[model samples]
Target: MELPIDHFRLLGVSPATDGQTVLRTLQQRLDRAPDQGFTHETLQARADLLRNSADLLSDDRHRTAYEAELTALSAEGEGGQSAIPALEIPNSKEVGGLLLLLEAGQAQEAFEKASRGLQPPQAPALGSSREADLALLAGLACQGAAEDYRQQRRYEAAARVLQQGLQLLQRMGQQPEQRRRLDLALEALLPYRVLDLLSRDLSASLERNEGLQLLEQLVRRRGGLEGESDAAFPASEFQPFFKQIRQFLTAQEQVDLFSRWAEAGSPLADFLASIALTASGFAQRKPERLQAAYGRLAGSGQAGVEPFLACQLLLLGQIEPAQALFEQGADPALRQWANEQGEEPLAGLCAYCRDWLEREVLPGFRDIEADPDLEAWFADRDVQAYVEQQDRKRARSAPLHPPEAAAGAGAGTPSTQSSLDAMPLWPGDPLASGLAAPSQPGQSGALSEPLQPEEDEDDWPDLALGWPNLHWQDLQLAERWAQLRTSAAELLAQPPSWVLPLAVAVTLGGVGVGGWLALRPKPERGQPIPVLPAPDGTVQTGAKPSPAATGAPKAAASPGAGAPGAPAPTPAPPAPRNLPLTVAKPSSAQLRSLLEAWLAAKAAVLAGATPEHPLEQLARSALVGNVESQRRENASRGESETVTAEVRDFSVTSQTPQRIEAEVTLRYSDARKDANGKLIASTPEGERRNTYVFARDGQTWHLAAFRASR
Candidate 1:
């Protein structure tokens, strides 16, 4: 008879058990067989099965052979994948459906389905071989799904799913290898999960603290919290990764985090604490913090901090020393370019440092959208902000701006000049605030590449994106921007080399249109000739003049210069009144109210409800078409969403009396669910920056156009 159970399962013992324990366990089971209420025949058969498994496992040769077979089967069950895949299990309707979903590249859907199937009353029995296949399938689905989430930067969800999967597998207990893999995956996700928590909104203190605790645990394994390397994390990536996450915290938070590390009294702690101080200095524009940062670096016992120290010096207006250190690090080609800009050597030096400096050395606070709550919180602090016209009025003052790019050490350093004349302190911006790397279409928030080796040095470098939009400086920023625009337009204007024949056709078509206008026959004199205006802004004339032509009916003598019986000329359309407009506070409030009501209606529409407002009142004209298409697309995927929308940065960029052109950042969040109430998609938060136009009648504005910024 073919027994479906493996030796481990049959014996109810782990592979780790010794041979003596295996045999003793079998003997003990046999002695207690009658307690199971089995008849003599059944008892004997049970004894035989237990004894047979024990005998095979008791011998080293038989145990090794059996394990080899099990390994081969395990590999086959796990799809023999180097990268994780859904476990290849014995076919059943549920398992087959799950696998098919995975095969179709719908990992989230597969994950949801598998999660539901593996829980509660739906979960299969644990004893049989068939049930074990389902168990392994559940583990595989969790792993594969978590991997997909990790790739999408959803580290929190990935770690949670992996942890749950690991616990589930431990309860199932047959596959040691599957359990180990799940544990490893969970371990790998810990650091990313911590990063995600730290990078989120600062108000989430509970989550951030949890991340900190996890971080402390990670360090403890390396040696302790003050160790130079990490156990789970790579040593090489330690500095840059920590530096990136530091920028996402406020100055107060940085100081607090550093204080914790400073108490540890190790070189690693000193280095980490120094990083916090440097970031805090920039965040609060505090000279004391910058000096403290430099002092802490001495205790760090770290090497290669010359560049960072140099930047600190520049910010403090130690121009001569800063300039020397900066130039020493410059590559040969860059040095040549710097030497070439002799007229304004400072400008070129600043551009090179700003563009070419490694991001690891750039330290600052979180760059979050302005919020009323955060503003209120910042206001009560003793710290001085950078935006005020006078820095001396504040309790905290500093040489906020950087030193001049090239140093004469006279009165012209950035730190000595008025804030407006120089760059704003770091809180204002490392470069300039509003003009910082203004996004062009398709280039939003992306860092452009540095100039190619063969590129002309005199031309604007792609890396110097902020230079073009930076209007206040004496730099010809606007002109450079125009040059780039003109260059792009010229490239787009030219026809493809292969499309010469199409160009020929376009030329012929132009000629044909002109010829048609010239060669057309003139209307007969008495055949109801229509009145028309002359191209030279005069009334049309016929060989026979009308009574109105001599100004008898002055208004009627305008365009309709033919006989008085001719049909009234179309009244001259009023001259288009196009002028730029600034959206006022009252208009802003009105539009915001309208948008909120519109979004509520849209949610109903997406959920398959036809509201009484009929979408026209909610989003008429141009918005209606966009709403309808979006609804249809979601519906095709068996999806629906209940969205909450908020608009920001609202402005009326331009307008006519009848039409208002505006732009806004639409912030919304939604969890999209299918017909079965299963989540198909989710965005905790999203922002859509775009411009739209509205047509106005009397009081109501009709949406005329809706489009994204890029």
Candidate 2:
């Protein structure tokens, strides 16, 4: 068995290598190789493999595995070399047949046949170096094609070819040039459209200047900045791109062309944020010098500078008018930042003010309740909805373009399959529409047809459940909870009507509520006692009134103290010094009347017949408990709501009158996930509990304060 040094060596180093080094080395080696019919194309292909492998090494884990393979191959020596396979080319006719299929716009069929019919490995030629070189070359070609496809906006096609490329490159030794090409391709294709789309979806209140700033950055990265030849694609062809961006610009766009020499770093233009501030300043100062400031800011590419200006406006509390100017400012990037912050560029400044309130301002008011309305204003749903609607409107107006056209028309070029094998051609911008445009007379037929993937919508890929997957789990839990609610409602309604009455009677037979003395049929021995409700949730009897039943202001006896039927205490409290003289003793008939009134109130409240009774408080408290538990369940699964609590001071004289104040807090949590199942490292998580505390106000308990922190 011949040792496969090429295979072992390919797997030994990083996937990326210096492209020039790999290309020159392969050319020299190919020149010395025996003329067993190896062509220059074969050598070129092997060099591509090295480059492709080098690119793969960028991913740490893949690099590690590949390196390990090299170690294993080197250690196995001859025995391991036997495992190396040889590859054979298909018949010329078969290759031609596949090429024809590809030219006919049947990419899927051509790929399938080519993959199935390809030859397996054989013993290495010249210690298997030739075989290894061939494998590496094939890999590089596939990788290069994949990348090219991606650049042309043929994502699906790119993915397919890239998979093939990766497999091939794994077998071939790492080539340097191929890796560089792949990197370039990936960089070119990485979608910047997401920023544009997301920005357009933000609130209208965001300064146009902000949006313009963002668009400028995006355009600059793509080499589309001002003074750069915007002429690469005719203005007519790129009208949609310009239109999509124009929303961020105010009517004050400078049609006046001023030539500026290109230099390194960010392009100098007045950022959108500054433009917004200038507009706002003009609105306020209405000064003759406004134009110069506006012009200066609009031409500079410094995005960060405008926020400082916006902050100055915010500090003067010129919020609404300043916001209007900002909203109309020309900068998409600035707009995106403002949109995310839920305000204009001065949001950080405003936040500083809010922080002061919590850190500085609030300390002074610790004893006094903060106004609840202030917090509620921020949670206004209508404002959020309006902003979302504005964003959608902007996106709807953006232009949609098709990906690049296919190759293989009478341009004197070979069929698409051959070209692909040589240098992969990509679908242009138009192809991204998922509907490739019909080929023009001189265009390639492969670019003419549209593709419809066959996979079902219900088919979800398997994924590893990591911390990042928690958001998904939260969603799943919510769906489950909804289903559970439906089933529970159905079950609750299924029972016979009379059954509820019987069940309630049995469960509540011994339970007591209010005065315990009312529940007791007769006085037991010498002391009076109150009845306690059943531990299990159920209906209960009301407690009795004291012997002095006038209902005037009375100091109630300590509960559970020296009462009949209670656990005996070895020690007792000091005896009462003065018994009340001429106290109105309660009559049996009066006691019966009071008990009847209490029962009636409880019954009416539970039936939802009326309110404004003592029993209503008890009912509301129970409802709170139920809702609290549900919220806890939801929190565990990673769903929450944004809530704010308000504290109020109240003095209610009705029913057990007491003067008091309390706090109320509300909160919510929503599930979130990243595009990939990786940790959404950007999102922050915190406590999910919401609490409301009430203090006594005269005879009643009123909410004093509420709080929610996430």
Candidate 3:
């Protein structure tokens, strides 16, 4: 048979060519091929190469398997024996078998084979390079096994396998390359280890110390705190673990460790030292060290570091310097830190700084103007003359009654009035003719002058109509008689014949009646007025009876009832009804209390306190249903964790007789540790707002439902 062409060579690409390169090469070959006439064998070869190239380059698993198969085939074709003999280490056959098993995805078999390989005794004088290769193979096997465990969420098992592999490599004194690979593997595995430990009951003991040491090793392998290695672990990925470890150490121990690390010039050492110093109260006693630590952080030129340093400075009572720093730095982190510190002025200053930098500095730089001396330019005679000419032109071009004329009219001379002949007038106005007439010179002058009041004549008003003191009553009577005579004469002139007779008769009748009434005797004294009986058999009197005599009900006798004969007995006032009970909305004090109670309960649960513990009781009193049940379950599990919630503010959005709705902002933190007292995980401190529905159980408000939001 003709020698089979390698797919890579046929495709005109290297064996290591990527999928895209392979596809591109295949496309080129297809495009160049003839449309018709080709041999069957050639077509078959092309198809085979295309398929094999795609398979080898597309998927990692497939590629790895193919490569291994190719290696095995090459070895077999060369001879019945391999070119490179396996090293004489613990169970070398098992080591080879483990590699084969791992490549085939037989992880269980691989783990069993690796375990068997690790069981044998080591040779006394293995070469260093050979030993390192063996150790490297063993680590790969263990890593495969650990990955298998991890896929099943068996974290503890994974950690155990990794730990065993690390120990083996350490004993063998792994080569630099081998050690780097193993360190990377361990770095990936550390988080799982921490979680496993925290989930178990081995936190406060030697296992915690071991785990911490493992973390330190990983940290050191990544170029220690200075972060000098390109392969250094990401701070974001490992910062929580570092914080956790520090949480387990006392302030003094932390200070000692931080001091040592700082002396060694670790990058994060200053930050750690600051925390330790603050916790140990050394910030107040030996502020110089604090200052040095902050100085180092500030010098790092890292984002957000300045804000923290400024906050610390402010706390230490260095107000002026802190203020200056806040006004200078434009970091958003500063605002957050200031808010957390409850320094409103500092926060405001940081906000101002951010605004200034964004709105003024950035835009000003983008649109900068040349700085010309405006005052000096204006002082030049030509420029001044030009400006004056423009002003005069504008003034002259303006209307006689400019818009500003009304405002400044009183400040200058009055404008001359236009002649009435030249002004428009409405038709039929009474003053139209008067205004239209041409004025005489004297008349115009007289019209312009203000009028003067006429002088009063006291002599004429003193006696013209004044009456003398001589018999004023008699004079009045005589005047009345004269008026009566005049009236009588006028009446007689128009009177009919009956008028005089009727008048004489009326006069005589009046005289006769007066004489008769004068002669009649007047009835005197003490006669009784009669009372009539009505059809209803009640006595009726013309005058109304007094309230006391009649025994009638008074208006004030009964509330909202009217007295008899009162105007329509004003409709009785509407019946008094109780208003809907207004359940008092939860106040900040109440929300804060609830927050404290909840935090206390969560802390108790994390501390592994029994359900009957006082803290649990307090928690139960504050919480209900699922929340309470969850606490109990956590407590039963003996979880070593603590949570604290601080309520910053709350608003009651709605309320009813039985329930209330409120939005609460709380800063929350949850810390977890292993049974050996080594912290493994903790939530970063942050503010969260939750809408809570509180149900009223009797008089106390209990949390019913809550939705956490941004």
Which residues of candidate 3, in runs, are more than 4 Å off? 1-143, 152-156, 162-203, 226-258, 279-310, 317-710
Q: What is the lDDT of candidate 1?
A: 0.48
Identify the runs in model 2 with alpha carbons over 4 angstroms from their true place. 1-87, 97-607, 613-689, 693-710
TM-score of 1: 0.32
lDDT of 2 by residue, 338-410 (tens): 3322222344234322322222121211012232121232233442233223222221222111122223233
CA-only RMSD, every prediction: 27.1, 32.4, 43.2
By TM-score, the best candidate is: 1
* lDDT comparison, 1 vs 2, better candidate: 1
Better of 1 and 3 by lDDT: 1
Using TM-score, rank the candidates from best to worst.
Answer: 1, 3, 2
The TM-score of candidate 2 is 0.21
| Steric collisions counted per model | 0, 91, 9
CA lDDT of every candidate: 0.48, 0.32, 0.42
**TM-score: which is higher, 2 or 3?**
3
